[model samples]
Target: MASSVTILFLLLSIISMGGALASSKPSGSSDPLIGEVCSTQSHLVCTNYDDVQATSIAADQVATAASMRDASIQTINDLQEDFFLESSLVEGRKIAIHNNLNDPAPSRPFVPSSAVSSLPELTTYNALDIMSYFGVARDSSMATAIVTAAYLCGGAALPGEAKSCAASTKALAAFVASELGNNVSIYATKGAPTTYSTSTSHVKAPVTILKVAKGSVEEGRKIVVCHHLAFPSALYYCHAVTGTKVIQATLKTEGRLRAAYIKAMAVCHLNTELWLSRHPAFKALNIARGDEACHFLVENDLVFTRALQTSG
Candidate 1:
């Protein structure tokens, strides 16, 4: 007979497999690339913008603009992959918890945030409007990502020489990740740490420690568990000490998971910003504080949280 943990993992795997299969199916109605690019109706404009940007890059005076455009496109694809992978793991965790606790599962299927429901007609977009779509703040990491993408995509002229968009985007992403106190190398390796370090070197403040009680050793432990489980390629177990209260223990575990989910999603948002900035269409527009974009990101995070809670 399979152990409970084995059964739990199997059930979770099936859910993940289903989502993957659904994503893999080819759509007959829409341009597949456009479908991949826009995850929601709100993001539809971004796809049109990307097309115009690509065309402009092809026609730019810089000799390397074409290559830069291709690189930018590839970066967007990479960001999409990162988003999907992170989302899958989070969804998988939700499934695992639900099954393990014998809770009712989510009624609806896991619809990806970026999944295209209908094909949108290509429309004209002003540079300002297109820039507004990204929802970037002038000094935010999103803004930096866009600038970096522009330089790489040959949308902006580099003073001395040109570099490949892929290389530039990668370097810029790493730099931004580091500046934001994220684990820069982790993005490339795409794996969770084997052992949780007591060191706070890479822990971003406010996100990791906010609302957590000071001098509460257990709270820190819970945060570490959440971080370990939520972001990485695999989940890690933290042993509960003997005789912990059942209700209290459950609440603690749930809190940790929630915190971890937020942190992981925030990272994905950061990555998305990097790719969003690089798209050719809005290269010339100035980035300002975008309340809508920021709200969308927060709303997406909340939706994920609610889905997990309701289903679990």
Candidate 2:
């Protein structure tokens, strides 16, 4: 795995090239930034239960990371703290990016109408040059967080899929409304959105997951999965998918009472055919052709579906 500095420069080179570093395609290969980051944190990817659970922890979480989504969900408060609240910067930056969709990697988040001030412009010759330009320490968490967000936002869209990065709750609402209409509800993993820990190996498998006795299990239609991003402020990389099914299940692992994890264990069953044959879900879940590969939503991910039955 390349160091964060290494990943940072990779993003810089892509920015300098000013081409499509990534497509809406989910394959790691589709996006260079995603590919490098995924390679660094292979354990966190959407692999099988054993692989995901057994994987070690990373120093920091990647935004829109191609990670395996399972495990101890974090608390809502933990999720809420990252937002910028009413800051106009969030909406301003997002709108700017949406307007200039073709600029695969934007250095400056310029907005003429925005009341916010101009932000620093990012540029570089290679991955390392940018790190040196910013004086970002090799161990700096920002090395990945900022660059990851940059690539995720600037990357291309998948066929028939619409994506956006919302830096605030208001911006998110607008994006969701634009994509799924107003009559929608968002279901996220209940409790705190937690990451798997070296200490909490107790949550690992060797336990059976009973029927999805809770949450919504509506027929396929339009569904949105918003992944929380790591940024200076709260940001989410959200994408809309069609013909996907969502559910919130509670598991009975090893006869222990359900942990106070996610309020609703939202799950998504991606259409297998539409996905690449090598998608982590396919290999991890042993999915057969023409079948769906279902997996738990990441702790930080939120699901937006038509308000079928609210998971209160």
Candidate 3:
């Protein structure tokens, strides 16, 4: 029984040792089929995993580029609006030039009227002079600010579209001019009513009397046109577009005061439109045609032929 037990123990020990040796051998070296399968599996896993990682990285790069493109487009639109607003002021000045050239009030010298003891001479209160005094440049920083706001609001557009804006502003200015004429005429022809006092500040400017024609003045129309001589200067007229009011110690003709108020309001509204129109992004996102955006304010009064007739 002792010999049988010892032999069994030796046989078991040999089998355990052999199994341990087989387990310790390198996998690739043990059998060609096993090695090939393991190698192929490892290669497949590496290739598949690496491809996925590459695809994810490429996608991230493409997304980043697209985001940058959108931001750049927005920036360009903002700039176009800025240009439009600043240019509008220039257009206003041009309109004034047209009106002034057609009118003869600036060329004539005047003597105070003896018949109307309460009033100054017609030449002294010329409308052209008043306009000259109030005309402001459109190239100012304030003008630029107005345009920028307009651009953001989608009110302004490229040069092609600027014509309409110019036309609208010019028409409004003409309307204001007509209104000023009436107000000045009333003050000149009908001495201030008992309700009003003619303080120095309220004293009528001589320039306000300049009329379109002799008949036009007597009929109660103060025909005056003004243009800004300075290319980039602001007139600080009776109005500013930003809702800031300027007080004046002099040149306080009722017409001028009223005109200032009107100008201030107009500037605020129009400036916003001008900048928005000229924005680069505005053009890119243009829902409307370019020509429709910018309109020219041609001064019908400024035509040489019209001036000749009116001056006579």
The candidate maximizing TM-score is 2
lDDT of 1 by residue, 132-192 (tens): 3333443343333333344324333222222222111122222222222222111001111
Q: Could you estimate the TM-score for every candidate?
A: 0.18, 0.51, 0.14
RMSD of model 3 against the true structure:
42.8
Q: Candidate 2 lDDT, tens digit per residue, 213-270?
A: 3223455678777776554434567788786656543322232354322222344444
Give candidate 1 misplaced runs (Cα > 4 Å): 1-79, 85-266, 270-312
TM-score preference between candidates 1 and 2, better one? 2
Candidate 1: residue pairs that collide? 39-114, 146-277
Model 3 agreement with the true structure over 10-39: per-residue lDDT tens digits: 111101111111222233333321121112
Q: Rank by lDDT, highest first.
A: 2, 1, 3
Off by over 4 Å in 2: 1-139, 192-217, 252-264, 288-290, 309-312
For model 2, state the Cα shift of residue 303 in Å.
0.7
The candidate 3 region of ten consecutive residues with least summed lDDT is 5-14
Q: How good is model 2 by TM-score?
A: 0.51
